[model samples]
Target chain A: MYRYLLHRILQIAITMFLLIAMVFILFRVMPGDPASMVLDPKMPPEAKALMKKQLGLDEPIYSQFIIYMKNLLHGDLGRSFYYGRPVYDVIMERLPNTILLFTSATIISWGLGYALGKRIAWRRGTRFEHALTFMGLLFYSVFLPWFGLIMIWIFSYRLGLFPLGGMITPELWTAGGAGIIALVLDVLHHLALPLFVLTLLSFAGAMLLMRSSMLETLREDYILTARAKGLSEKVVRDKHAARNALLPMVTALALSLSFSMSGGVLTETVFSWPGLGKEIVSATLNYDYPLAQAAFIFLAAIVLMANLVADIIYAYLDPRIRY
Target chain B: MSFFEIQGLRMHYATSRGRVKAIRGVDLKMDKGQALGLAGESGCGKTSLGLSILRLLPNNAHITRGRILFHGEDLLRKSEEEMRRIRWKYISMVFQSAMNALNPVYRVGDQIVEAILAHEDITKDEAKERVSELFSLVGLDPGRAGQYPHEYSGGMRQRAVIAMALACHPELLIADEPTTALDVIHQKQIIEKMDELREKLGMTMIYITHDIAIISETCDVMAVMYGGKIVESSKVRDLLRRPMHPYTQGLIRSIPPLHDSVGRLTSIEGEPPSLLSPPRGCSFNPRCAYSRDICRTSEPPLRQLNGGLVACHFAEEIPWP
Candidate 1:
C-alpha cells in the first residue's frame, strides 16, 4: 500500500508539472499582455517597452517558463497587475469562501440524494419511486445559470426574504459593531439562495448514480442471504445493500467536490458572491496572469488530491479493493 | 402433524412477457431429523421451493396459493415480522451458489455473527463465540474466520456458508446444491461435512440437487421433480429400485453406473418445458416415453402408490425392470 501511495504521489507530481506547463502555455497564447493591461495605450513605445521588461515579458518564452517554475518552487505566485497585490494573498482571500460554499453544498446535496436514491431503488416499481426519479432528473438537468436566476427572482427579488446578491450586506458589515454571531448569520442568510440552487442542481447526479448502483446491489446473492438471515427490511436495505452500493458514489462525490472547488462559475457570478470562481473570471478577463494561472493550478491540485482521497476511502470501505 | 409440510404450494414470477409458473401445485412432508433430497433438472423450481419456505422469494415472485406448515403452524399465513423471526432462527438456507451467498465486504465470521445477532437476544461476544464454533464445526480454521469471503477458496466459502446456516441451530436447514461449484475433491469433502453435521445435530434438512448419485449417497428420501412439480417421491432405495414414473426411470438410467464396463450413457432427450407457457395438460407428457392421448389431455394428481407417491397416468401399466 505504501508503494502504491508512492507511485500515485509520483504520478500526481508529474501531472501537476504538466498542468503547470499547460497553464503557462495557454495563458501566454491568449491575446493581451499584463503590461498592456497595466500601461495606458497612449504611452510612448519606450515607456511601454520598459514596463514590459519590468514585468519580464520581453524575455523569450523558455526563460520565462524557467523563471516561473523556479518561483513556483519557492511558493511564489507573482503579483496580480489588475489587483496590484500578491496573487497568493488575493486567491487565499477567496479560497475559504468558495470552499465553505461548495463543500457544504456538495455534502448536503449528496446526503439527501443517497437517502432518497436507496429508497427509490428499493421501492423501484412504486409510484413514489417514479415520481421522485422524475423530479430528481428535472432538477439535475435544469440549466444552472437560469435556475440560479429564477431562485434569486423568487426568494430574493419577489419575496424579499434574502439579499438580492452578494455574500454579505455591505452596509451592516461596514457598520463594524455587529457581534460575530450576527455577522455569521448574515453571511449564511446571503448564502441561502446560491447554496439551495447549487444543491438542487448537483444532487440529481448522486441520486441517479446511487439508484442504479443500489438496484444492481439488490440483485446480488448476498442481499438474499441478508434477507434470509431475518434482517429487518430496513437493515437489509441500509446496512447490507446501501453499504455496498455506496462504493461508486464515493468516487462521484470526490470528483464533484474537486470540480466544484474551482467554484460554480455561474452560481458565484449570479449571486455576486466573492468566490475564487468570480475572481478567476475577472482575473482572466483583465489579463492578470499570476492570479488566473494560480487559480487554475490550485484547481488541478485539488482534483488530484480528491482522487487520492477517494481511492483511500474506497479501499478502506471495500475489502475486495486491494492496492 | 409432520415437522414440516408444504401443501398445494404454487408460485409464479411476473416477468415482462407474462407470469412464469415457476412452481406448479406441489405437496411435500418431512419428519423431524430427516434429510429429504429434491432431484431435478435446472430451472425445475427447487431453489424457489426453498426460498418459499423462508418467505425470501424475489419481489417479482408471488405465492399464488400455499400453506407451508412448520411445527403445526402455517408459515405462509405468518406476517412479515413473524416470518423474519422464523427465518434464520427456525429455518435457514445454504444457497445454491454458496460462494456469492456471503457478503463480499464483510468478514465471513462477522456475517455469521450478524445472522446470529439478528434473531437471538445475545451479546455480540456470544455471537462471535458462536461464529467461531460454527467455523470449527464446518471444518474451517477458526483463525481464518476474520478473512473476507473473497479470501476463502470456493470449497472453504461453501463451508463458511454452511457454518452461517447452522449459526442459530435452525430446526430445518435447506442445502441447495451446496457442492455445485466445487471440484470433485471439494464436493466429496462438503458432502462428508454435511453428512457429519446431519449425524451430529440430527436437524431436518432438504438437499436440492440435480445429481441423483449425490442424493442417493446423502439423502434418506428423494423426490424427482419435472417441470416445477414432483413426479415421484419414495425412500432413496425404493426410488432407485423402482422408479414408477417414466421421467424418474429415465433420470436414473441417465446416471453412469460405477462397476459397469464402457457402455453408452443413456440420456433423456428433449429440453425442459418453459414455465411461461407450459403444455396444456401434464407438464412432462411431451417428454414421457409412455405418453398417450390421455396423458396429453389431463394432468395426473399425486397419489399414493406402494407406500410412496407417484404422479404418472400409467404408473401401474409401465412394467418395471
Candidate 2:
C-alpha cells in the first residue's frame, strides 16, 4: 500500500507539472498581447514597450515558461491584468462562494439520487420505477443553461418565491445596512434558485447510473446468498445488494467533486452568483491571462486530487481493490 | 408429520423459447436427522428442486404446482413474509458457486454475523462469537474470518460458505453440489467437517452432486434423479450393492474403478435431454441401452421394488449392479 501511494503521488506531481507547462505555453501562443490589453491605448510606444518587458511578455516563450515555473514554485501566481491584484487573491476571494453554492447542491442531489436509484432498480417492473426512470433521465439530459433560465423565470420571476439574480443585495452589502443574521438570510434567499437549478442539473445522471448498477447487483449470486441467510427484504437490499451496488455512485461523487472545480460556470453567470465560474468568465473576456491560468492550475490540482481520492474510495468500497 | 417433505413439486422456467419443465412431479421426504443425497448429472433438476424448497428460484421461474411441507405446515401456501422467516432460521442453502456466494466487500466473518443477526435478537458481540464458532467448526481459523472472500483460497471460500449456511443452525440445510467446485482433498475435508456438524447438531441435510463418489461419502440415503424425476431411491449401501434401475446401473458403472485403469470406463451413452420440449416418454429413453418399447412410450412411475423404490418397467430383469 505504501508503494502504491508513492507511485500515485509521483504520477500526480508529474501530471500537475505537465499541466502547468501546457497552460503556460497555450496562453503565451494565443493571439492577444497581455501588455497591450493591460496598458492604456494613449500610452507612448516606448512606455508600451516598457510595460511589455515589465510583464515579462517581451521574453521568449521558453524563457517565459521557466520564469512562470520558478515563480509558481515560490507560491507566486503573478498579477491579474485587469484587476492589478494577485491572481491567487482574486480567485481566493470567490472560492468560498463557489464551494458553498455548488457543494451543497451536489451533495444533496448525489445522496437523493443514490437512494432513489436503488429503489428504482429494485422495483424495476413497477409503474413507480418506470415513472421515476423516465423523469430522472429527462431531467438529467436537460440542458443546464436552459434549465437554469427556466427555473429563474418560473420560481423567481413568475412565482416570486426566490430572489431574481445575484449572490446578495449588493447595495445593502456594500453599505453594511443589514445585520449579520439578515445578511446570512438574504444570501440563502438568493442561493435557493441557483442551488435548485444546479441540483436539478446533476441529479439525474447519478440516479440513472445507480439504478443500472443496482439492477446488475440484484442479479449477483451474493444477493441470493443474502436472501438464503434469512435476511429481511429491506436488510437484504440495503446491506447486501445496495452496499455493493453503490461503488459506482461513490466514484461519481469523487470524480464530480474533483473535476467540477469550475462547476456551474454558466449557471453562476446566469444567476450572477459571484462564484469562481462567473469570475473566470469575466477574466476570460478581459484577457486576464494570469487569472485564467491561475483558475486552470487550481482546476488541475483538483482533478489530480480527485483521481487519487477516487482510487482510495474504490479501495474502501471494494475490498478486492488493494492500494 | 415428516420433518420435511416436497410433494408433486413442479418447477418450470420461462425462457425466450417457452416454459421449460425443470422438476416435474417430484416427491422427497426426510426425517429430522436424515441426510438425503440427490445424485444426478447436470440439468436433471437437482439444483432446481433444492431452490424450490427455499422459494428462491430466479424471476423467470416459479413452482407450477407443489407442496413443501415442513413440520406439517404447507410451505407453498405460506405468504412470502412467512417464507422469509422460514428461510435461514429453519432451512439454509449452501449454493453451488461458493467463490461468488459471499459479498466481496465484507469480511467473511461479517457476512456470517449478519446472517445470525438477521433472525436472532442478538447483540453484535454475541453474533461475532457465533460467527467464530461457525468458522472454527468448518476448520477455518476464526481470526481468518476478518479477511475478505478474495483473500481466501477457493476451497477456503467454500468452507466459509458452509460456515455461513450453518450460522442460524437451521434444522434443514440444502447444500447444492457444495463440493463440486473443490479439489479431491478439500472435498473430503468439507464432507468430514459437515458430517461432524450433522452428528453434533442433528440437522436434516440434502446433499446434491453429480459425482456418486461424493454421495456415498456424505449422504445416508440416496435418490437418483434423471429427467427431473427420481428413478430410484434406497439406502446408499443397498443402492450401491444392487442398483435395480438400468440408469442407476449405468451410473454406478461409469465411476472409474480405483484399481482398474482399463479402456475408457463406461459412461451414460447420450447427453441429458433438453428441458424445453423434452422427449415424450422416459426422458432417458434416448440414452438408455436397456430402453424397451414400453420405456419409449410411457413414463414409468416410481414403484416399490424389493425393500426399495425403483422407476423402471423391468427393474426385476436388470439382475445386479
Candidate 3:
C-alpha cells in the first residue's frame, strides 16, 4: 500500500509539472503584454523599456521560463501586476471562499443525487421517477446563468428568503462579537441561491448515472444469491447492491471533482462570487497576463489535487484497482 | 409424506411480443432421501421450474398455476415473509456459474458464514466454526476460506457454492447445472462430492441439467422436458433402456456412444418449438421423425406405459432402442 501511494504521489507531481509548463507557454504565446497594462500610458518609450527590463520582460522566453521555474521551486509564484502583491497571497485570500462554495456544492449534489437516485431506482416505473427525470433534463439543458437568474428571481426577489448576492450583509460585518455569527449566517443565506443553481444543473447527471448503475448491479447474480440466502430486502439493496453499484459513480465523482474547480464561469461572474473563475475571466479581459497565468496555475493545481485524492479513494473502495 | 411435492406447476412470462409459456403443467415429488434429475435442452423450462419452487422468477415471469408443497405446507400460498424464512433453511439452491454467484468483494469464509447467520441465531464465532465445517464437508481446505472468490479456481468456487448451500443444513438442495462450467475431472469430483454429501446428510436433491450421461450416473429418477412440458420420466436405467416417447428416444439416440461403429453422432432434426405459439397438438411434432396425424391433431397426456410415463399419442407404437 505504501509503495502504491508513493507511486501515485510521484505521478501527481509529474502531472503538475506538465500542467504548469503548458499553461506557462500558452500564457506567453497569447498576444498581450503585461508591462503595457501596468505602465503609464503617457510615459515615453525609453521609460517603458526600463520598466519592462525591471520586470524581466525583455529576456528571451527560455530564460524567463528558467527564472520562473527557479523562483517557483523556491516557493515564489511571481507577483500580480494588478494587485501589486505576491500571487500566492492573493490566491490564499480568495481560496477559502472558493473552497467553501465548491465543497458545499459537491456534498449537496452527491448526497441528494445518491439518495434520490436510489429511491427512484427502487421505485422504478413510478410517477416520482418520471417527474424527477423530466425536471432533471430540463434544468441541465438550460444555460447556467439563466438558471441562476431564475432561481434568484424566484427565491430572493419574490420569496425574500435569501440575500440577493455577495458573501455577507453590510450590517453583519460591523455587529460586534455576535458579528462573526451574524457574518456566518449571512454568508450561508447568500450562498443558498448559487448553491441551488449549481446543484440543480450538475446533480441530474449524477442521479441518472447512479440510477443506471444501481439497475445494472441489481441484475447481477450475486445480488440474487444474497436474496436467496435469506438476507433482508434492505440488507440486499444496501450492503450488496449499493456498494457494487457505487463503483462507476466513484469514477464519475472523481472526474467531476477535477473539473468543478472552474465553477460555472457565468454563474460565478453573475453572482460576483470572487472564485477563480471570475478572477480568470476579468484578468483575461484586462490582458493582465501575470494574474491570468497565476489563476491558470492555481486551477491546474486544484484539478490535479482532486484527481490524486480521488485515486486514493478509489484504491480504498476497490482493492482490485491500484496505481 | 414426501419432503417436497410440486403439483400441476406452470409459469408464464409476459413479454412485449406475446405471452411465453415457460413451464406447462407438471408434477414432481421427491422423498426425504431421493435424488431427482430434471433433464432438458436450453429452452425446456427446467430452470424455470426450479426457480418457481423458490418463487424467485423475474418481474415479468409469474407462476400462473402451481401448488408447491414443502413438508405439507403450500409454498405458493405462503407469504413472502414466510417464504423468506424457509428459503435458506428449508430449501437452498446452488445456482449455475458459482464463480459469479458468490459476491466478489467478500471473503469466501465470510460469505458462507453470512448464509449461516442469516437463517440461524448464531454468534459470529459460531458461524465461523460452522463455515469451516462446511468447507471441510465440501472437500476444501478450511484454512483457505479466508481467501476471496477471485483467489479460488473454478472447481474450488463451485465447492464453495456447495458449502454455502449446505450452510443451513437444508432439507432439500436444488442444484442447477452446478458443474456445467467445470472440466470433466472436476465435474466427476463435484458429482461424487454431492453423492457423498447427500448420503451423509440424507437430504433430497433436485438436480437440473441437460446432460443425460450425468443424470444417468447421479439421479435415481429422471424426467425429460421439452417445450415447457415433461415428455418422459422413469427410473434412470429404465429410461435409458426403453424410452417410450419419440422425443425421448431421439434424445437418447443423440448421445454419442462410448465405443461405436457409427462415424457420426445422431442429432434431433430441428429446434424446440417456440413457447409463445407452440404447435397445435404436440410441441415436438415438427422435430420428431415418428410424428403422426394423431400426434399433430391432439395433445398427448402423460400416460403409464410398460414401466414409465410417456406423453405421446402413439407411445406404444414408436420403436425404441
Candidate 4:
C-alpha cells in the first residue's frame, strides 16, 4: 500500500511539474506584452524599457524560467500588477470562498446526480426518468451566465427574496460583535444564489455519466449472482450494482473537475462573488501575468490532487485496479 | 407431494422482433435430497428453467405461467418480501462463471457471511464461523476466506461460491453451470465437490449444465432440454445408458465415447431453432435425423417409455433411421 501511494505521489509530482512548465510557456506565447499592458501607450520608450527591465520582462526566457522556478521553490507566486500586492496573499484571501462555493456545489451536484442516476438506470423506461434526463440535459446545456442571470431575475430582482449579488450584505462586514452563527448564516444567505447556479451547472455531467455507468453495471453478471443470493432490490442495487457503478464515476471525477471549475468561474463572476475564479478572470482581462499564473498553478494543483484522490478511491472501490 | 415441483412453466422473452418463447410447458419434480441435472446445448433454456424456479428471469423475460411449488407451497405466489426471506434461506443458487459471481471488492468469506446473515438471525461472528466450516466443506483452507475474489484462483473462486451457496444450508441448491469456466481438472473437482455436498448435506439440488457426461457423476436424475421444451427426463444412469429422444440421442452421440473409437465425433446438424418463430410442430424436427412427416406435422407429447419419459413420435422404434 505504501509503495502504491508512493507511486501515485510521484506521478502527481511529475504531473504538477509538467503543468507548471506548460502554463508558463502558454503565458509567454500569448501575444500581449505584460509591460505594455501594465503601462500607458503615451509613456516614452526609455521609461517603458526601464519598467520592463524592472519587472524582469527583458530577461532572457531561460533566465526568466530559472527565476520563476527559484521563486516557486520559495513559495512565492510573484505579484499582481493591478493589485500591487503579493499574488499569494490576494489568492489566499479569496481561496476559501471559492473552495466554499465550488466544493459544496460539486458535492451536492454529484451526490444528487448519483442518486437520481441510480433510479433512472433502474427504471429506465419510465416517464419520470425520461423527464429527469431532459431536465438534466437542459440544465447541463444551458448557457451558464444566461441561466444565472435568469435565476437572479426570477428569485431576487422580481421576487425580491434573495440578495441580488455579491458575497454578503456590504453593511454587515462592519457590524461589530455579530455572533459567528449570524455571520455564518449571513454568508450562507449570500452564498445561496451562486451555489444553486453552480450546482445546477454541475449536475448534468455527473447524472448522465452515472446513469449510463449504472445501467451497464445493472447487467453485470455479479449483479445476477447477487440477486440469485436472494438479496432484496435495495441491497442488490446499493451493495451490488451501485457499488460497481460508482467506480467509473469516481475515476471520472478528476477529469470532470476542469469543467466544473470553469463553471465556477462563470458562476462566481455572475454573482459578483469574490473568489479565485473571479480573481483569475479579472486578472486575465487586465493581463495581470503573475496573478493569472498563480491562479493557473493553484487550479492545476487542485486537478492533480483530485486525480490523486480518484486513484485512491479506485483502489478502495475496486480490487482489480491494483497499483 | 414432491419436495419441489414445477408445472407448466412458460417464460417468454419480449424482444423487438416478437415474444420468443424460451420455456414452454416444462414440468419437473424432485424428491427431497435428490440431485436433478438439467442438461442441454447453449440457448436450450436449461439455465432459464433453473432461473424460473427462483423467479430470477430478466425484466424482458416474463414467466407467463408457472407453479413452482416448494414443499407444497407455490413460490410464484410469494411476495417479494416473502421471497426475500425464503431466498438464500430455503433456496440459493451458484452461477456459471465463478469469477463474475462473486463481488471483487469483498472478501470471499464476508460474502458468505452476509448471505448467512441475510437469511439467518445470526451475529457476524457466528456467520464467520459458518463460513469457515463451509470453506473446509468445499476443501478450501479457512485462512483463504479473508482474501478477495481476485486474489483466489478460478477453482478456489468456484469453491467460494459453492461455500456461499451452502452457507445457509438451503433445502435446495441450484448450481447453474458452476464449473463451465474452470479448467477440465477444476470442472471434475467442482462436480465431485457438488456431489459430495449433496450427499453429505442431504440437500436437494438442480445441477444445470450442458455437459451430458458430467450429469451421471453429479446428479441422480437428468433432464434433457431442446429448444424451449424438455424432450426427455429419467434417472441419470438410465437416460445416459439409453437416451430415447432423437435429440437426446444426438446429444449423447455429439460427445466422443470414452472407450476409444476412431470415428469423427457426431454433432447435431443444425443450430437451435429460433424461439421467436419456431417450426410448425416440433422445434428440433429440422435438426433430427429421424424426424418423419408426423413429427413435422404434430408436436410429440411427452409419454412414458420404459421407466423414462420421451417426447418423440417414434420413441418405441429400435433403429433411429
Candidate 5:
C-alpha cells in the first residue's frame, strides 16, 4: 500500500509539473501585453520601460520562463499587477471561501444524486421515476447562470424569502460572535439560491449515470446469489448492489470534481459570490497575468488532487486496483 | 406426512414481450433424510423450482398456482414476514457459484453467525461457537473462519457457503448446482461432503444440477426435467438403468463414457423449445426420435409406471438395453 501511494504521488508530481508548464506557456502566448495593461497608455515611455523591467516583462520569453520556474521552485508565485498584491496572498485569502462553497455543493449533490439514483433504479417505470427523469433533464438543459437567475427570481424577487446576493448582511457584520452566527446564517440564507441551482444543474447527469450503474449491478449473478441466500431486500440492495454500483461513480466523482471547479465560473459570477471562479474571471478580463496564472495553477492542483484521491479511494474500495 | 411437499406448483415470468411459463404444474415430495435431485439442462427450470420452493423467485416471476407445504404448513399462503421467519430457520439454500455467493467484505464466520443470529436469540459468543462448529462440520479449518471469502480457495469458499446454509440446522436444504464453478476434484469432494453432511444432519435436500452423473451419485430419487416440466422421476439407479422418457434416454446417451472409445456422443437433435410459445404437445416432442402424431397433438401426462412416474406416450413400447 505504501509503495502504491509513493508511486501515485510521484505520478501526481510529474502531472502537476506538466500542468504548470502548459498554463504558463499558454498565458504567455495569449494576445495580451501585461506591461501595457498594467501601465497607463498616457505614461511616458521611459516610465513604462522601468515598470516593464521591474515586472520582468522586458526579458526574453525563454529568460522569463527560467525566472518564473526559479520563483515557482522557491514558492514565489509573483505579484499581481492588477491588485498590487502578492499572487500567493490573494489566492490564500480567497481559498477558504471557494473551498467552503464548492465543498458543500459537492457533498450535497453527491448525496442527493446517489439516493435519488438508487430510488429511481428501484422504482423504475413508475410515475416518480418518470417525473424525476424529466425534471433532471429540464434542469440540466438550461445554462447555469440562467438557472441561477431563475432561482433568484423565484426565491429572492417574487417570494422575498432569501437574501438576493453577497455572503452576509450589514447588521450581522457589526453584531460580534452572535454577529458571526448571524453572518453565517445570512451567508447560508443567501447560499441556498446558488447552491440549489448548482446542485440541480450538476446532479442530473450523475443521477442518470448512477442509476444505470446500479441497474447493471443489480443484474449481476452475485446479487441474485445474495437474494437466494435469504438476505433481506434492504441488505441485498445496500450491501451487494450499492457497493459494486458505487465503483464507477467514484471515477465519475473524481473527474467531475475537477470539471466542477472550473465550470462554476458563470454561477459564481451571477451570484456575485467571492470564489476562485469569480477571481479567475476578473483576473482574465483585466489581463492580470500573474493572478490568472496563479488561479489556473490552483485549479489544476485541485483537479489533480481530486483525481489522485479518487484513485486511492478506488483501490481501497476494490482490491483489484493498485497504484 | 412428508417433511416437504409441493403440490400443483406453477410459476410464470412476465417479460416485456409476453408471459413465459417457467414452471409448469408440478408436484414433488421429500421425506426427512432423503436427497431428491432435480436434474435438467440449463433453462429447464430446475433452479426456478428450487427457488420457488423457498419463495425466492425474481420480481418478474410469481407463483401462479401451487401449495408448498413444509411441515404441514402452507408455505405459499404465508405472508412475506412469515416466510422470512421460516427461511434460514427451517429452509435454506446454497446458491450456485459459492465463491461469489458470500459477501467479500465480511468474514466467513461472521456471515454464518449472521444467518444464525437472524433466526435465533443467541449471544455473539454462542453464535461464534456455532459458526466455528459449522466451519468444522463442513470440513474447513475452524481457525480460518475469520478470513474473508476472497481469502479462501474456491472449494473452501463453497464449503463456507455450505457452512452458512447449515448454520441454523435447517430441515430442508436446497443446493442449486453447488459445485458447478469448481474444478473436477473439488466438485467430487464437495458432493461427497454434501452426502456426508446430509446423512449426519438427517436433513432433506433438493439438489439441482445439469449433470445427471453427479445427481445419480448423490440423490436417492432423481427427476429429469424438460422445458419446465418433470418428464420422468424414479430411484436414481432405476432411472439410470431404465430411462423411460425419450428426453431422459437422450440425456443418458449423451453422457460420454470415460473408458470406451465411443463415437461422437449422441446429442438431442434440436434446442429445447422456447417456453414463451411452447409446442402444443410434449415440449420435448420436437427433439424426440420416437415422436409420432400423438406426440405432436397431445401433451403427455406424468403417469405412474412400475416404480415411478414417466411423462411419455410410448413409455412401455420403448425397448431398453
Candidate 6:
C-alpha cells in the first residue's frame, strides 16, 4: 500500500509540474500584451519601455520562465494587474466562496443522484423509472446559464423566495449591526438559486452514470447468489448490487471536482457568486496573466488531487484493485 | 408424499422475439437424502429448473405453471417473504461458473457469513464461526476466510461457493455445473468432495451438469433433459448401461471410454432446439438419427419403460447395439 501511495504521489507530482508549465505557456501564447493593458497609449515610448522592463516583460521567454519557476517555488504567484494586489491574496479571498457554493452543491447532487439512480435501475421498466430517467436527461442537457436564469426568475423574482443574484445583501452586510450568524445566513440565502441550479444540472450526470453502472451490476452472478442466500430484496439491491455499482461512481465523484470547477464559471456568472470561477473569468478578460495562471494552477492542482483520491478510494473499495 | 416434488413445472423467458419455453411440463420427485443428477447440454433448462426451485429466476423469466412441493407444502404458493426464509435455509444453490459466483469485492468468508446470517437468527460471531466451519467442511483453510475471491484459485473459489451453499445446513443442495470452470484434477476433487458431503450429511441433492461421467460417480438417479423436457431418467447404472431415449443414447455414446480403444467419437447431430419455437413433435426429433414420420408429427410422452421413464415413441423398438 505504501508503495502504491508513493507511486501515485510521484505521478501526481509529475502531473502538477507539467500542469504548471502548461498554464504558464498558455497565458504567454494568448493574443495580448500585459504592458499595453497597464500602460496608456499616450505615454512616451521610453516610459512604456521602463514599465515593461520593470514588469520583466522585456526578458527573453526562457529567462522569464526561469524567474517564474523561481517565484513559484517561493510561493509567489505574482501580482494581479487589475487588483494591484498579490494574485495569491486575490484567489484566497474568493476561494472560499467558490468552494462553499460548488462543494455543497456537488456533494448534495451526488448523494441524491446515487439514491435515485439505484432506485430507478432496480425498478427499470416502470413508468416512474422511465420518467425520472427522462427528466434526468433533460436536466443534464439543458443550457446551464439559461437554467440558472429560469431558477432565479421563478424562485427569486416571481416568488420572492430568494435574493435575485449576488453572494450577499450588500446593504445588510455593510450595515454593521448584524451578528456573525446572521451574516452567514444572509450569504446562504443569496446562495440558494445558484446552488439549486448547479446541483440539478450535475445531478443528472451522476444519476445517469450510477443507473447504467448499477444495471450492469445487477446482471452479475453474485447477485443471483445473494438472492439464493435468502437475503431480502433490499439487502440484495442495496448491499450486493448497489455496493458493487458504487465503484465507478467514486471515480465519477472525484472527477466531478474539475467538472464543477469549469461549471463554476457559468454558475458563478449567472448567480454573481464571487468565487474563483468569477475571478478567473474577470482576470482573463482584463489580461491579468499572473492571476489567471495562478487560478488555473489551483484548479489543476485540485483536479489532480481528486484523481489521486479517486484511485486510492477505488483500491480501498474493490479488493481486486491491486494499485 | 414425496420429500420434494416438481409437478408439470413450465417456465418461459420473455424476449423481444417471443417467449422462450425454457422449462416445459417437467415432473420430478425425490426421497429425502437421495442424490439426483440432472444431465443435459447447454440451454436445456437444467439451470432454469434449479433456479425455479429457489425462485431465483431473473425478471424476464416466469414460472408459468408449476407446483414445487417440499415436504407436502407447495413452494410455488409461498409469498416472497416465505420463500426468503426457505431459501438457503431449506434449498440452497451452488451456482455455475464458480469464478463469478462469488462477489469480487467482499471477503470470501463474509459472503458465507452473510448467507448464514440471512436465514438464521444468529449473531455475527456465531455466523462467523459457522463460516469457518463451512470453509473447513468444503476442504478450504479456515484461516484464509479473510481473503477476497480474487486471492483464491478457481478450485478454491468453487469450494468456497460450496461452503456457502452448505452454510445453513440446508436440507437440499442444488449444484449447477459447480466443477465446469475447474481443471480436470480439481473437477475430480470437487465431485468427490460433493459426493462425500452428500453421504456424510445425508442431505438431498440435485447435481446439475452436462457430464454424465460426474453423475455416474456421484449420483444414484440420473435424468437427461432435452430442449426443456426430461426425456429419460433412471438409476445412474441403469441409464448408463441402457439409455432408452435416442437423445440419451447419443449423450452416453458421446462420453469417451477410459480404457476402451479409441474410435470415431459419435456426437449428437444439430443444435438443441430453439425454445422460442421448438420442433413440432419431439424437441430432439431434428437431432435424432431414428426420427420417423410419427416422431415428427406427435410429441412423445414420458412413460414407464422397464423400471425407468423414457420419453420416445420408439423406446421399445430401438435395438441396443
Tens-place lDDT per residue, model 1, A1-323, is 99999999999999999999999999999987777679999999999999889888899999999999999999999988788899999989999999889999999999999999999999999999989888889988899989888878998889999899988888888999999999999999988888888888888788889999999999999999999999999999999999999999999999989987889888888889899999999999988888899999989999999999999999999999989
Write down the C-alpha DockQ for each prediction.
0.92, 0.82, 0.70, 0.73, 0.43, 0.90
lDDT, candidate 1, B1-321, per-residue tens: 999999999999999999899899989999999999999999989988989999888889999997999999999889999999999898989998888999989999889989998888999999989888888898999999999999998989999999999999988999999898999999998998998898899899999999988989999999988888999999999989888999888898888887787577778889899999989778888887888998888999999998889998889999777
State the weakest 10-residue window (summed lDDT) of model 2 chain A: A255-264
Best by DockQ: 1
Candidate 2 displacement at residue A184 in angstroms: 2.0
Question: Which of candidates 1 and 3 reaches a greater DockQ?
Answer: 1
- Which candidate comes out best when scored by lDDT? 1
Badly placed stretches (over 4 Å) of model 3 are A1-14, B259-264
Candidate 2: regions farther than 4 A off: A175-177, B259-264, B318-321
Question: At residue B201, what lDDT does model 1 achieve?
Answer: 93
Interface root mean square deviation per prediction: 0.7, 0.8, 1.1, 1.3, 2.4, 0.6
**Comparing 1 and 6 on TM-score, the stronger one:** 1
Backbone clash numbers for all candidates listed: 0, 0, 0, 0, 0, 0
Which sequence of candidate numbers ranks them by DockQ, best first?
1, 6, 2, 4, 3, 5
Better by lDDT, candidate 6 or 4: 6
Docking class of 1: high
Cand. 5: chain B TM-score: 0.97
Tens-place lDDT per residue, model 5, B246-268, is 88888988998767887778888
* Stretches of model 6 off by over 4 angstroms after superposition: none
Q: Residue A254 of candidate 2: its Cα lDDT? A: 83
State iRMS for model 4.
1.3
lDDT per residue for candidate 5 within A1-323, as digits (tens), equals 78877887898889888888898888888787787678899999999999899988889988988888899889999999898999999988776667667767777788888888887987788999999989988987988777788888899989998778776676667765674566678778878877877887878888888899999987776676566556677877887788878899998888777766663777777888887778898888777878998889878887878888888898788755555
Q: What is the TM-score of chain A in candidate 5?
A: 0.93
lDDT of 4 by residue, A1-323 (tens): 78988887898788888888888888888888777678999999999999888888899988998899899989999988888899999988988877788777888898988999998998888998999999999888889899899999999999987898888776777967787788889899888888888788768789889999999998888888788777889998988888889999986766565434533677777898888888887888787888989888887777777787888878878888777
DockQ of 1: 0.92
Alpha-carbon lDDT of model 1: 0.91
What's model 4's lDDT at B249? 83
